[model samples]
Target chain A: MTGGYMGRILFVNLSTGEIREEVLEENICRDFIGGYGIGARIIYDRQAAGVDPLGPDNTLGLITGPLTGTPATTGTRYQAVGKSPLTGGWGDANSGGFFGPYLKFAGYDAVFFNGIAEKPVYLFVDNGKAELRDASHIWGKDTYETEDTLKAELGRGVEIACIGPASEKLSLISGIITRRGAAAARSGLGAVMGSKKLKAVAVRGNQKVPVADKERADRLRSEQIAEMRTPVAGGQSFIERFHKYGTSSGAHRSALSGDTPVKNWGGIGVVDFPEPDSLGGDNAIANLAGRAGCWRCPIACEGRLKEGTGEYRYPAGTRRVEYETQASFGTMCLNNNIESVNMANHICNSYGLDTISAGCTIAFAIECYENGLITRADTDGIEMTWGNHQAIVAMTEKLAKREGFGDVLADGVKVAAGKIGRGAEQYAVHIGGQELGMHDPKLISPRRPSQPSAARYQADATPGRHTQGFGPSGFRGHFLNAAGLCMMGQMAADPTKYLVGFMSAVTGWECTMDELLKAGERIANMRHVFNLREGINPIEWQVHPRITGNPPQEEGPLAGVTADIKAQVYWNLGALDWDMITAKPSRRKLLELGLDDIARELWP
Target chain B: MTSRGSCGLKPDSHRLNTSWYEGSRRGQEWKYCPMFRCVVGVFGLPREVTELREVEIELEDGARLRDIIAALRREIPALEGDIICAGEDRLTDNYAFNINGRFYQDENELQVRPGDRVALLLLASGG
Candidate 1:
């Protein structure tokens, strides 16, 4: 058996109240690795085609990778996998906090939840014992309140992954929040959890995750830490900057250089939001009450904001706003009020909402209102104007509660556009149903014909995600996520110096770079195959003309820069050996990746 | 020393290239004396760390990308050993060199024409 896994999986059916414990096979662990790798494989085999994502038939897996709770630096992530209620295809979201490690310690490698409970319930896993407890009292509470309530009842040591009011209302843009505000906040999996009438999964355990070669693992960890401590080509180490500023440090530069989308991808950054320095590193850390790290991560990037004292007041200790949140609320809506943006972050965290979708939705609303497509009456008397910080925060809280106009936007821009019809689709900037990440694709250099960053947005299995599908680098990223390693961890250290070495030590596998690459490719293919079986055609996915710069912008840093998305997508497809039109991986390629069964299933 | 130098700019004239002067030297009044100047945009690094967001660098007539980088290292003490390694023109995988909208991953042979826009930017990866 592999050293990292708990060798156990819990399959709980809420509808029938059937609780079954199954042995996690070593072959499955070795073949797929862990996290979404194992999740994608299992869901593809077990779930039927076209199963309603919010229905009982759709299974949800909360999975952690082998390195999750181990001595590996930033081994602090877990994946939430199911058919996405948002994209309606292959879906997965990962979060970093204490929950993933605690779940492993609670004596399970993964937990698969199915069916709707007769009443609201929460799963309690203590040591090696697991059971369902009534959760009626905490169902309506926000995530922060729910955490406090559960901890008071369960114990202070328990780590929880739970939904808030937004999820309970089944907002499609909702997600699961843990440990105050760390969110697995994409794919609308929170709606899936809510649909199952499950509120939370609280875990506490003391078991240590076994490492095959503890000596080697410890040595590699020390070496990696030392490398991180050593300054980069620049005097300051990457970890030093990350620990100090987090992603907020990148916000100003991203905006100025055209990497960050401004005015909902329709306006330019430098021209629209000239003074972005206020939102950058120095200001980002101005209100930092403390630093937050996941598990044993040395690069404690996440920060706790000091209490709000201005107009938009929020409680102290709210999770600091990340770059994505900053862009989505700051430049995207043209609202530069730091306090309001911070308050918006607070609202989203408390309600368990995806800030990307929520912020983008508000920007969409602002555009719609400006065009006279909607009015103050529709917004419940709040003027949905660009840079109206008060209105933005008001609308965000309304969206969290799913009230009035908020109900129209709670699902995201894609769904809101559908409801508002009269040419509102033209203003909706989304790929499929998910809002594009804060990064802009038009910023890609024209010299690089096959730039992976630009194309990954459209070609990745989960369309519109910035983090997935980077040809070869993406393969490693998939494996990293599966291994429960934080991307920040990989970024801080020289991964070539320690990534494969650390994995080999922890899993007791003679995992060479070649072998790890193949595993990553296999994992990527498995995820793509899941989408193919669901009848999603990658060729037909439409990227907004504004995003592609169809009729190039007249000003700003990215002026006249139109992304050749179709060519890039085709290039990506050819590289992956997938049929361009059908978007299915070739049988030969699948077989080469050791996906013999998947190859047969597709080729058959 | 001629008031109108080789590049045809006055020694103490208000040529006012704020990008360079404001960032590197915040308050000191200095004369622009170089025969050739290229505007360099610094991206992906924080203002506090780099001290200069953008700066116009003085280089020799046949300056290449490496020379501009070397000049930047010498002028900006914060960036001396950070973006590019000391005494090495090659950039690690973490950084990229973008000149006139074209990106060079590790290419050191690219010629830097006078008045070219050279940007020292971090490669987009990671969160």
Candidate 2:
């Protein structure tokens, strides 16, 4: 097992079908020098802090870094992580094909998983043998017919990853799906892999990684791929208008920079399209079937869209759809039909959903069906209209077959606005159940000194409207998913000119992006002590009180944009979101947030 | 068959063609139709006839789309970029040219003739 950067660490439990192995532990790969810092130090060291992300005492954590599965341009993604059941926070998610460098050349860098499995199984590795068998006919399939019936019953060099039946019926806006519509989506972690009754994995290894000094890490990876393939500092006319209209060629540049998020937020025009750049510019050149990349990625923003089938039927395969499910289900739920957002990203990757909280809770049930608060007898008779792309692909298959009222919208938008109340939680454009991630931070208006809500939701925690330290107060400090960089090269570098030269080059460890932003402030205060040991303190956060102390969205160009959340609580916002300005903090935000062992497990 | 930039057998990018990134990365070098790039740079094949469907390369009859953009600006001096008119008048046209179909996306919207089935595109920006 020579793979220099790591050797193994596979685990797997499927409730005792047992298969273990650990080895690769050089002080956990020299202080987390891997993508997402060694999966947040293996879930903050075997998570105790009230686990239950989808119970079976949660654990998924998948990982793979040292530029996992190599050729590290976009460092072969990987991630997966756990503790999320939609916004219990601290759930990680990452993806890219070539199944994370074929699980780090079959000699894993991580894998974990745990309990709950008496039936419907499936694990099957190749190089370093693994089993877990019998998936009672691919457990209610649909992650694109279980990756085409397991490469047609395990034939042509396999590589899989699965979850559907809304993560085997654990849907809090589930996710996982690989290949047929790529997605390790976010947060809901496919209801933490259907609370662990796990059903699909399939790796294939081959080895040959070892290269601590393979000619000086291939000459610092060919000088960071010749400074990320030249043409910069002048915005390659915004990266060739983003690889010629991919990233839903910015749904008409985010509704012409009013930063699109209509319907549910209650307004913003264009009912039935013609221009949002002519239906998001010919839906980015008709599902552009040209590029693809993941393992050893080179910003090959993996787009490969073949017309699904005549009469323009896109979403068959060669998946990739990013840019927040192309602006959370294209044009923030107004649907400028890119073949109905490629058939709502193939019914959320064939039913393993999470198209940004299923397109922000289907634009909050079409604003509670245009405010009669759910009619057509709570929508079973469909007519939740507003640019109906065939009733948003028959309500994402009745919100992933939870059927009628899509079982209160697969229970998202804060338990479907606490089981459909008429105030309709003042327009459920979600917060706590992870939705706002597609940049509608009310259109980037920040100057920061304190960060007073940087625009809004000042502090209604929901891991969704994230970015607490408000993007390291405009660049020089940068935090947007640290260690997992690229908010498009943090909109072109400066997180203090590359966080101390990207931590003294990966991890020969020499800190200073203010001490590697104290490990992203001890991984965001150990995910707020794992969501205050699952009690979710600070008065159990949740938002959309028409967005705390309102101002933004009253009508586009961020009508009246507000929230300067007390300039990040009188400038001491420190270690970003430090449980929002002291119920008790300071010790220089915990020794500049080395976060004394997560403040001694969140104050003992 | 017309192996240019992604090794031209082009049967729908013929099953993930990775003969290690197709022969020294696009050398059968570049250029096309400037008198068939000096006959495919001394004969490698830009034409033994390379049509894989979608024909209609203008000039076959009563021409005039500016006389086939002046005979493809005298056979591809990068035809000064732009052209489209591919199937379905590319939804309400300026003859759909912000390129990105097969090449020429700088704007100068390439005009065509000789019977015009012109599919190749570019002029692209945001969707």
Per-model CA lDDT versus the true structure: 0.82, 0.56
lDDT of residue B57 for candidate 1? 59
- Report the C-alpha lDDT of model 2 over A490-534, residue by residue, as the tens digit: 343444544444434443454466555555445444444555556
What TM-score does chain B alone reach in each candidate, compared with the true chain B?
0.63, 0.17
Q: After superposition, how far is residue A250 of candidate 2 from its true place, in Å?
A: 4.9
Task: Pick out the ten consecutive residues of candidate 1 chain A with the lowest summed lDDT.
Answer: A442-451
How high is the TM-score of chain A in each model?
A: 0.98, 0.33
- TM-score on alpha carbons, each prediction: 0.89, 0.34
Q: Taking the tens digit of each residue's C-alpha lDDT, what string does model 1 give over B1-127?
A: 1111112122233443332332235556664433467766565552335655566655545667776666555556566455667666556555666665456655666778875656666545224
Query: Highest TM-score: which candidate?
Result: 1
Which CAPRI category fits model 1? incorrect
Off by over 4 Å in 1: A445-451, B1-126
